[model samples]
Target: MPVQQLRSGDHAFVSYADDDAGREVVTTFTWTGLARHEKVMVFSSPRTDESEVWNSLDAPGPLLGAARERGQLVVSSMRALIHPAPHFTPERQWQRIEEETGRALEEGYRGLRTYIDMHWVADLDADIAVMMHRESHAQHLFTDRPYTEICAYDSRSFAPDVLTAMHRAHPCRLLSRLGELHVEQTPGTVYLAGEADVATREQFLSAVREGLLRTADERRLTLDMSQLIFLSAACAVDLLRLAAASEDHGIRALCHPTGVRILRMAGAENMPNLLLSEVTR
Candidate 1:
């Protein structure tokens, strides 16, 4: 089947039983759809079967040639065949995957189109959800391009928890030091990852309220509490209030496992948007 007509910044996932077929899809999507048309951004997964795949595309001369010619970007992955139910509990495995995915996104695509192609089929829903969330939420994934394109291939079912954790660990540069703020924009959403006290929380709330008031457009907002080591009842209230204030804007808050217990003690049922992890590797 031909690759789908994806939006300019949409992620395009190409999955096939044959390596040649997968390579062809990537080539067509980058060369014909993006390069030739100059109207779309493409991204594949980090797991592909072909190592010399880029060199095989003669029409584009080189993968970079097509990109330079059309003023777009093409991204692919190293050869990795992962099992659908394979265990990923190892700490190093997760770190390796994150590192590889991060490097691919940063160096392969030079600000044009973004492409990602996973070589194996794990959890379809989780992979796609993670891809969408990361490409849309994390800022450092694309150095110059501010758009997102995430595609996932699946030959099986979906695991919500696994997907959520994957999204949490979707390889973005961590903002070090407490109280530092980072504004991130992704497809269909924006997130603010930082640390803060009561005062900073209030400021964030104000910014969020203004964002909601100023745009009337629905957006998903995530407050990453992965770094927050301490909490107070007042801070919990501030978070809940933030969620309540931005309810109309589709804003949601996320915290780590410890944050969950703290919020619960503070009388908050932080569900749906609270991304919890089974194992922190």
Candidate 2:
């Protein structure tokens, strides 16, 4: 699934190695938000020119144009999101964000979604420790709230260590050891793509919750993982937990040959109402 299809309460982190890649990530997310009748906000970095960002989104397309006209799409830059304050306080910045979400709802949008380019963090010589703390705790803002965000970091600019720490802080990741996960719902099945590893533990659990939300207990849910390339021990445990708890919900996880082996070795076979459909090579 595209980043925008993430649950309304999802707080996602996306890392890009290049400018074009970042633009594609933001444009796709903003486009989807508009289609869903949600308000969109974007903060571009100096490397990503504002005009180019707008053009890359297919400037003046009917939907984009209409959204702009309705004031549903708001694009600012790192300079604007962080200026006027002598020092950066994540708390105050976060407050402004919460207020904007409420404003969007009042203006009749379904919800509010924002993407922030974190290149400024490096540019301004900001406090990384404080930023990490803020990112980790931002999860609180999403609980049962119609707010979604993607904090994008430019891999080229951010130190490798910083990137690793950021990944651990965010709940959902656009890319990780698991490639990129797209959890989608069909009539009776929940399909998963990409890799699931320790880095994606929370996202894995969230996917199961999302699947359950869209499903009823009477019918068995078929979780198709044919496209999943890998699964880690930690992620497997979480998957099993959900499957075991889903006894009443009934779940069938279709996995790659290796995934089946992992589950069996992990003792998931003992769980009732959870069937493992192994894919054949």
Candidate 3:
């Protein structure tokens, strides 16, 4: 039986002996296991003769209906692994599987499976090491604080391609949580999403500090408060304090639909410097 926890999109390495026992194992797995219900891609050693099983799969059979329901597997050939391999080596194979999966996804294949033939009985250490190295970094976009020149790019003059290149170059990766917080800066405007809680207050304050400290050195700054959710009373006080702290910093805080409502609810709707404007969702 297959591992119940082994999910559909998972990649795996399957190895066996070269004799009849190994062939029978492979045939059984293909016929009754993967080919029946799962989407499985197999990478095998060149020596294995799987043509018979492949041909039989083409004809209508009990497994055919199940196989047709899920995504098809991609079977490839790889070099045989000798026994007693190190742990990290498996990571390379995993990387290959991920790349192939990405390609399949890019080509509009929503589901895929990968199975590699290690051809070795024991390599727990190597496999563990490889698994460790399989960790991946996500792509992210971030604006440079005034203090950091590396992230400083003129968004207005920057061609979309150039901006894309810059984004690609820095790859400012952060947790998905921060992704929702849009901190955009331009010569004449700065759009920032503010949060209401203490944590969000801290983030907004930090952004304000960065802008205030850098505005004279740079130029315009606009703060966009559209989806400004909840904010604590202390947080609102600190936001008011940011207005007091700035001297010559040309930081304009733009309040949109929800932001206007929030400010009105907080009784700060009459603030002179706060700019409430209309913005499309």
By lDDT, the best candidate is: 2
Task: Estimate, for each residue in 86-155, the C-alpha lDDT of model 3 and write its tens digit.
Answer: 3335444445445555564564554344333333212232342232233222111111110100112223
- Write the candidate numbers in order of decreasing TM-score: 2, 3, 1
**Per model, how many backbone clashes are there?**
17, 1, 11
C-alpha lDDT (0 to 100) for residue 63 of candidate 1: 39
TM-score of 3: 0.33
Off by over 4 Å in 2: 1-4, 59-63, 176-281
Task: Answer with 1 or 3, whichever has the higher lDDT.
Answer: 1
Cα displacement (Å) at residue 226, model 1: 4.0
Question: Per-residue lDDT tens digits of candidate 2, residues 23-135?
Answer: 77787788888888999998778566777777877746644777778899988865576567656678867877888889999999889999888877766667999888888
Cα deviation of 22, candidate 1, in Å: 46
Give the alpha carbon lDDT tens digit for every residue of 1-281 in model 1: 12333333333333244555555555655564444334333333434323354464444455366454543443333223123334333233234444544443465442334344543234233344544454345444333433434343331233555444544544322222234444444544345545445646665555555545544555545444444444456767766666565555454445556666777776566444333332121
